[model samples]
Target: MTDRREWPLYEVFVRGKRGLNHVHVGSLHAADSTMALRNARDVYTRRNEGVSIWVVPAAAITASSPDEKDPLFGPSADKVYRHPTFYPIPDDVPHM
Candidate 1:
């Protein structure tokens, strides 16, 4: 006999505000895409904690491993010149 107890895994992304990018919160399982989305909303956004939510299949998620992280993100560590430290901003600047 075969067991029919498996469900698709979903990854959740939530945005804090209307104009912000969605940040990954967590993952869960559901039967279908629509159900997965609804489950995510209920699971991650119980208190209106986020303005938006995104759910994608966990299988679709592709990422570099820790061993590759150093080589992948290491370039940014040495590129201090790319930072705003060299750029002189007026004290009057609001967010800068």
Candidate 2:
């Protein structure tokens, strides 16, 4: 049996039938991508709540740190044109 410590960590994402995008569910350890996918399906969708599954190696993911939030995302805050507040919402528009 392979030692648990040697297994690579995987991040699992699942998309439900009604959901338009995949959401992060949890993490697990697996020996390979195939195993990781299978494990994610069994672990996350036992009740068949999900229509799709995605397993990504934890090592392959690059994430921004909270400390770098200002430097990374602050620039976008100044771009007021990016927001749709200037547009008038018609009374006929539903859910606007």
Candidate 3:
């Protein structure tokens, strides 16, 4: 008899601060959420570069296909309101 346990895939993300975006570290396997966190610490935190960690199942990731990348995202390019270029930066503003 064989012990047939399937490991759930996880997507690991780490961030150094609230201002920084979480970056994908690598993938690992765990039996449960607790184990997933511990495994992430063991793998991604070894460098002491991250202040936070997040693990999400890879299967849960719904992403647009690369083949549709242009059609999916290109429309947003015309939405100038998303960019701050319309506003004249005040001299008082530190970072524009």
Better of 2 and 3 by lDDT: 2
- Measured on C-alpha atoms, candidate 2 has an lDDT of 0.93
Expressed as tens digits, the lDDT of each residue in 1-96 for candidate 1 is 999988989999999866479898999999988999899888999987888788989999897899998889998998888877888889899896
Alpha-carbon lDDT, every model: 0.88, 0.93, 0.86
TM-scores of the models, in the order given: 0.79, 0.79, 0.72
Question: Which regions of candidate 3 are displaced past 4 Å?
Answer: 1-6, 17-21, 76-82, 86-88
Predictions: Cα RMSD each: 2.2, 2.6, 2.8
lDDT for position 17 in model 2: 95
- Candidate 3 residues 1-96, lDDT tens each? 998888898889888665378899888888877889889999998878789889998888998899998988989988989887888888999986
Which regions of candidate 2 fall more than 4 Å away from where they truly are?
1-4, 75-82
lDDT comparison, 1 vs 3, better candidate? 1
lDDT of 2 by residue, 4-93 (tens): 566889999999999999999999999999999999988999998899999999999999999999999999998999888899999999
